[model samples]
Target: MRATLIYGLGDVRVEDVPDPVIESPTDAVIRVVLSCICGGDLHSYHSWTDSNPKRMGHEVIGVVEDTGADVRRLKKGDLVLAPFTYQDGTCSFCRAGHTTSCLHGGYWSRFDGGQGEAVRIPLADTSLFRLPVGGDSELLPSLLTLADVYGTGFHAAVKGGVTEGSRVTVIGDGAVGLLAVLSAQQLGAEQIILMGRHCARTDLGRTFGATDVVAERGAEGVTRVRELTDGLGTEIVLEAVGHMPAYEQAIGVARSDGTIARVGVPQYEQAPVGNASLFGRNITLTGGVAHVAGYVERLMPAILDGTVNPGLVFDRTIGLDEMAAGYRAMDARESLKVLLRP
Candidate 1:
């Protein structure tokens, strides 16, 4: 089987690798039908300096190839979507809505990443969600988002307490950020302001539900958002850019006593969180790795019903052989997101 492996910055390779097999009773092996590059994957793609190559990819929709004796829920031909992480559904964290933090859970890219032809899924019964739609369904793209980006955006909005008539400002216009705008819209937000510099992406953001678009950056951008809100800023700021400047912008556009929910994988460790930043203004900071598996059941019906189409984020598609080119497209911001067919 061929899989994607990153040697370091800008170096993506597709090479033949050994096939995966079930090693645990809770495990199942699936032949990947669909997969994609994630914004989070770019973090390692940009900074990986290790001598060893790292496996890449997480979001996957595949057909079950085989299952261990204990994996009773899935069969050899069942279609399923594996969230970025695998979790034992019986754990304390799983029950608390923190499926990403499950006691026996771990991310998919650690080994046998979904970019490969086949993957060994641990804790299969609870981690892999069986899809109602067929593999050839046009809904495949939208169903795939339930594995990461879409659910992540929903996480940001939910954490920020978006509700009917709420005023919200979403920072960044990446896939997750744009989806954040959609989530806010679905939650009944009366105002959705999207902060992005790219006209193409911000336009899609508007289609997704952004009532306004702020193309400026830094202080100028902050001023634009404030001016839009009668100088009060938004009550909810969804920070989707995980950069220090983006954090600053979230602080800049958040009304006093508001919330900042960040879903972008942070690129840096330290940022302003003192009195001058979030503390003095009574801003509550929230959001982390999305519990995508937990959100799949809740968000699936919408996709199946054609109520929303988050798959618009995948602007390009490539075969496993074009893995490097796909990465280049995404890193250069030439593609909103890249879908992979293995």
Candidate 2:
């Protein structure tokens, strides 16, 4: 099997690797139907210093080829989408609805990789969601988005307390951020503001429900967000960019007593948060690794029925062998999102 491996910063390759086999009684082997490059994957690819080759994908939709003896919720031929973090449905956290932080689930960082031709899914019953047998092909891309990007975006909005008539500001314009724009609008935000410099992405955001686009760089961006909200700042701010600057922008644009959901995968080990600033502003902050379980299930029906189409964010598509090119396209910001057929 050919899988994507990240050897070091600015280095990614497709190399032949042994095919994954069922290793647990609860395991299921899936043949990758479609996968894609994520902005988070690019962050890890660019930041690591060591030449450690590991599997690279976390978002995937595939057909079940085999299943472990104990797997009952899925069988061969079922097409499923899985959250990047695997979980045992029986775990206390999972039962409580925090599948991503399931005590029995492996920390996402410990996994070998998800960007490969095939993968062994552990805890199949808990992690996989089977799509309708005759689901819409046009909806596959949006369903795939639920596996991660859209899920994260929805989490950002929901976590930030977005609701009907709320003023919302999305702090990034990447795929997740674009989806956040859509999620916010779908959730009934009265006004949605997106902050980014890229014309293409900002345009996409507008199409996805962003009511206002702010192209001003850095601090000016925060000003524009405040201006859109009549100087009160937005009621809810979604921080989808996992970088220091984006985090600051989220915090800056959030109104006093408002909420900021930080969904961006943080790039640095230590990010300074000023208690005094937060204290003075009295802003509520909530977010972490997204709780994708319930959100995926809730959003799937909308996607399948075409109520929401997150697939519009996919600007490019390629084959498994063109994995490196996919990464480059994302790194250069030439593509909003890349979908690969395996």
Candidate 3:
């Protein structure tokens, strides 16, 4: 089997690797159906340190080819979505909705990642969500988004307290941030504002329920948010860009008593949070690595019903062999997301 191997920054190679087999009674082997690149993958694609040759992706969906004896919830020939983090499902934290931090939390890049032909899933019963057999086949890419991006987006809005008629602003227009906008609207937000500059993305955001679009990039962007909210800032702000500037901007655009949900994956060595700047403002800071496990079931119905096409974020699609082009398209921002078929 061929798997994507990361030899260094900006370096990805499709090398023949040994096939994976069940190594645990709780494991299952999946024939990857579809996979895609994520913003997090870009971190490894551009970073010098994350360049260590290793398996590279954490988002994917597939068909079960085999399952271990302990895997009672799934069987061979089932279609399923694999959570990026594997959990036992009975752990205290898993029951508490923190699957990302499960007692047995681990990363998987099937074969090398979901980008491969097959993958061995650990903690099978707990980590895999089997999709209905007769469901919409065209929905796989969108359903695939639920494996990570959609789940993360839902977490961003839920953490930010998006309730019926709440005023919300999503700080990043990347796939996750864009989906956050959709999640907010789906939850009944009356006024949804999207902060972004790209024409295609801003258009997509509007389709997803962005009532207003702010094209400004920096401090000017902050001013726009304040102006939109009558200087009170938005009631709920989602920090989806995992950068210092994006972090501060989320804080800057939020109202004095607003809540800022930080969902962006940080790559920086240090982040500066000023005490005085946030102290007197009554701003509530929330959000972190998303609890994706809590979202799969909650989002499955909506996605299966076509209430959300998170797959719209996938601006391009390619074969697993075109992995390099997929990376280039995302890195150039020429595409918002890319789906890979093995």
Candidate 4:
């Protein structure tokens, strides 16, 4: 089998690797049909300095090839959506709808990255969600987004308290950010403001539900958002860019009582969160890793019915061997997202 490996900064390769096998009673092996290169993957591809090669990818939709003895929820030939993080659905956190924080769960990459021919999923009964239909469904790409991107975007909107007639601002124009715009629309936000510089992305944002697109950055960007919101800023701000500047923009554009839901993977180790920046305005900061497994079931119907097509984010599709090119295209902003067919 061939899999993607991140050797070091700016280096991604596809090389032959041993195929995975069920290692636990609850484990299942899946033959990947489709996978994606997430923006979060870029963080590891660019900054990881470790000498050891790490398996890549987390977003995947595949067919079950084999199942462990105790795996009852899935069987061979079943098509399923594997969330970016694997979790034991029976955990307290999972039961409470926070699967990302499950006591016995971790990233799928820790076992065997999703960007490969096949993967061994632990806790299969609780980790993977079987699709309503099986075998090369037309919704494969859309279903693929449920594994992470759309669910995470939906999580950002949910955490920010977006509702009917609410004023929303989304930071970052990446795939997740665009999906956040779409999610905000689905949640009934009357006014959606997207802060992005790229014309193409902002255009997609508008299509996704952004009523306004602010192409400025930093203080100028904040001013633009304020001007659009009558100087009080937006009611809900979705921070989908993991950079310090984007975080500050989210803070600056949030109203006094507004909430900022940050779904972006933070690049900085420490963020300046203090009374002067948060308490003074009475703004609530929330959102972390998304509980994708929990949200998948809820969002699937919309995708299946063609109501929400977050799969549009996949601007390019390539074979497993072209993983490096996919990374470069995403990093260069030449592609919004890349889907890999293994």
Candidate 5:
């Protein structure tokens, strides 16, 4: 089997690796049909300085090839969506709809990377969502997004309290941020402001639901948002960039008593969250890694019916052997998202 491995920063390779086999009674093996590169993967792709190699990729959709003795929810030939993270459905956190924080859960990379020909999934019954049989091929890309990006964007919107007629500002124009705009609109936000300078991405943001695009940065960006909001910042600010600057911008542009939902993977070791920055303004700072498994089922219908097309984020598709170039294209901002066909 050929799998993607990150040997160091900016060094992704496709190499032959041993095929994964069912290792536990609750595990299942599946042939990966489609997978994708995620923005979070870039963090490791850019900064990983470890000497040891690591498996890459998490967003995956595949067909079950074999099931463990204890697995009953899925079987051979069943198409499944494997959320970026795996969780035991019986855990308290999972029952409470926070599957990302499940007591016995971990990322797909822990067992088998998604950017591979096939993978071994542990806790198959609880970790994988079997897609409806006979779904169209056109829906595959959208269904693939449900495994991560779309669900993540939906999580950001929900956590930020986006509702009918709400004013929303999304800081970051990456795939997740772009989808956040779409999610905000679907949730009924009347005014969506996207803060990003990239022409292509902001254009997609507008199509997604952004009523305004602010191409400014730092304080100027905050000022632009304030101007659009009539001096008070937006009601909900989504920080999707996952950096200190993006976080600060989100904090700066959020109105007093507003909420900032940060779904970006934080790259900083520490963030300032003192009274001067948060408590004094009565601002609610929330958001973390999305509970993708929890949101997938709810969002699947929307994708199936074509109400949302978050899959548009995949600007390019490449064979598994071209994954390194795929990473380069994404890192260079030449592409929004890259889908890999194994």
Candidate 6:
């Protein structure tokens, strides 16, 4: 079996690794069908300094190859949506729809990488959502979104309190940012200002329901967002760029008493959250790792009914052996998102 491993900063490789097998009663082995790269993966691509390489990739769609004795909800041949994290469904946090905090849950990279031939899924029955579609469906790409990006976008909108006729600003034009625009649209936001510099990506943001696009950064970007909102800023700000600069922009574009939902994996430890930032405006800080397993069912119906196509975010596809090039393409900003067919 081949899997991606990150040896250090900017170094990603596809190397042969041992096959996965069921190690616990709650486990299941899956043959990966489709996987994709995420912006969060770039955080590691930029600054991983560990002595040994770590497994890479989390979002995956796979078919059940084997199951442990305790696994009842899945069987061989079942195509499933494997969210990034695996959790025991009955845990208190999972019951509250916060699967990311499940007592027995953790991310995929802890063991097998999604960008591989196969993976052993822990807490199988609860973590893997069985998709109604089959392996060869044209909707696979969209269904794959339930694994990470799409749901993450929705988490931002939901946590930020986006609602009907709400005014919103989304920072970043990456897949999550563009999809956050889509999520705000689905929630009926009347005004969506997308702050991105890339024409191609910001163009997609517009198509996803951004009423205006601000192709600026720093103070200039804040000025543009405020101008679009009559110099008052928006009711909700979705910060999808995990960088410190984007965080500052989110504060700038957030109206008094508004909400800032940060879905991007934070790249820094210290940030402004006091009177100089959120406290001065009475703004609330929310959002964290998305509970994709919890969001899969709610978001799947729209895709199943063909009401929306979130898969447009994926701009490239490669084989398992081509993952090295895939990482380069994404790192260099030549690809919006890369899909892997293994």
lDDT of 2: 0.84
Q: So what's the TM-score on candidate 6?
A: 0.98
Residue range 106-180, candidate 2, lDDT tens digits? 643255456778888888888889988443377788888988899889888888888899899898899999998
85: Cα error in model 6, Å:
0.6
lDDT of 1 by residue, 236-328 (tens): 999998988999899999999999999988888998999998899999999999888989998998888999999999999999989999998
TM-score of each: 0.99, 0.95, 0.96, 0.98, 0.98, 0.98
Off by over 4 Å in 5: 133-136
> Per-residue lDDT of 1-342 in model 5, one digit per residue for the tens?
999999998999989999988888999888999999999889889888879778998988899998889998898999999988878999899999999999998887865799999998889999999988453488888889988888888899999999999999999999999999999999999999999999999999999999999999999999999999989999899889899999999988999999999999888878878898988999998999999899988888888787888888888999998999999999999999999998
In candidate 3, the residue pairs with backbone N, CA or C atoms under 3 Å apart (3 or more residues apart, or in different chains) clash, namely 109-112, 109-113, 110-113
Q: State the TM-score for model 4.
A: 0.98
Please estimate how well model 5 matches the true structure, expressed as its whole-model Cα lDDT: 0.91
Q: What is the C-alpha RMSD of each candidate to the true structure, in Å?
A: 0.8, 1.6, 1.7, 1.0, 1.1, 0.9
- Candidate 6, position 116, lDDT: 89
| lDDT of candidates 1 onward, in order | 0.93, 0.84, 0.85, 0.91, 0.91, 0.92
Q: What is the number of residue pairs that collide in model 4?
A: 0
Which pairs of residues clash in candidate 6, taking residues 3 or more apart in a chain or in different chains? none
Which pairs clash in model 1? none
Q: What local lDDT score does residue 183 receive in model 4, on the 0 to 100 scale?
A: 96
Candidate with better lDDT, 4 vs 6: 6
Reference-based lDDT, residue 255, model 6: 94
* Candidate 4 lDDT over residue span 80-101, tens digit each: 8899887888878999989989
In candidate 3, stretches whose alpha carbon ends up further than 4 angstroms from where it belongs are 50-52, 110-112, 134-136
Q: Put the candidates in TM-score order, highest first.
A: 1, 6, 4, 5, 3, 2
Instruction: Please give me the total number of clashing residue pairs in predicted model 6.
Output: 0
**Where is model 6 poorest over a 10-residue stretch in terms of lDDT?**
104-113
